[model samples]
Target: MSRKASGFTLIELMITVAIVAILAAVALPSYRSYVTRGRIPEATTALASKRVQMEQFYQDNRTYVDAPAGNNDTGTSTYFDFTAAPGGAETRTATGYVLSAVGKNGMTGFTFTVDQSNAKRTVVSGVPGWTDTTVNCWLTKQATSC
Candidate 1:
C-alpha cells in the first residue's frame, strides 16, 4: 500500500499563516469602518424613532418638558436631553429635534447632526480616523432633518 503524506512542510505552513495574517491586517480596519457605518444607521434610526416618540409625547402630554415613562426593552421610554452640545444625547423640543448621531463620548467616528430650525442635516467624520457626521439621508417634518 502507498503511504499518504501526513502534514504540510514548515515553510508552506508558515507562508499560509503569514498570508492569512496579512489579509486579516488589511481587512480588519475596513471591517471596522463598515461596522461603524452600519452603526450610523442604527443610531439614526434610534434618533428618528425617539423623535417620533417625542412628537407623540407632545401630542399626548401637550408639552415636551417631561421625560416619558420607561420601557424595559426599547431603552427609549425616556426623552434624551437635546440640550447637550453637538455630540451629546439626542434632544427634542415640542417644535423640533436636534442632535448628533456619532462620535459621542470621545468615540472616533462620524456623527449625524440635525438642526431642525434650518431644515439642515449632515454626516461628519471630524478627523480622518474619526468618522464624525450626521445622517442626513432621512428626514421628517419641515422643522427637522437628520
Candidate 2:
C-alpha cells in the first residue's frame, strides 16, 4: 500500500526558516536607509522653498518678516511651512540662515546657516512675528538681495 510522506524533516524546516530570517535581516535595514535618504531631499526642498518665500516677502513687504501668519493655512501666503514641509523648522538671520529643528530634548538643533559674507544675503529670526521653531517662513525686501 502507498503511504503519504511525512511532514518536512527538521533539517529542511530549519533551512527554510534560516533563509527567511537571513532575507529579512538584510532587507529591513536597507529599507530603513532608503526611507531615510528619501526624507533628506524632502527636507532640502523645504529649506529651499523657505528661502524663496523669504525673498518674495522681502519684495512685497519691503522688509524682512518672519513666520507670517496664514502661510501654512493659505497657499497665497508668501512664507515657508517648515513644520508642514520637510526642513523641520528654520529661520533667516540678518546675515545668515538660522535654521532650527526640534531635537530629542526640549532643546532645538541648528541645521545650518549661510552667512551674508558667503551668500551676500541677510538672514535673521525671532522678529516681531517669528520664533525659533515656528519661524518656518520668512519675508524678504525689494532692495535686499535675500
Give me the candidate number with maximum TM-score. Answer: 1
- Cα miss at 72, model 2 (Å)? 10
- Tens-digit lDDT string for candidate 2 (79-130): 3223322232243433233332212111122222222122321233333222
Q: Model 2: residues >4 Å from true position, as ranges?
A: 67-97, 101-146
Every model: Cα RMSD to truth: 7.3, 12.2
Instruction: Give per-candidate clash totals.
Output: 20, 10
51-135, model 1: which lDDT tens digit per residue? Answer: 5665666678775544341121223322222222242333444555454444453334344444434333544545444434344
Q: Which regions of candidate 1 fall more than 4 Å away from where they truly are?
A: 1-6, 60-97, 102-107, 115-120, 126-146
- Candidate No. with top lDDT: 1
Clashing pairs in 2: 57-140, 58-139, 58-140, 58-141, 92-123, 92-124, 93-123, 93-124, 94-123, 94-124
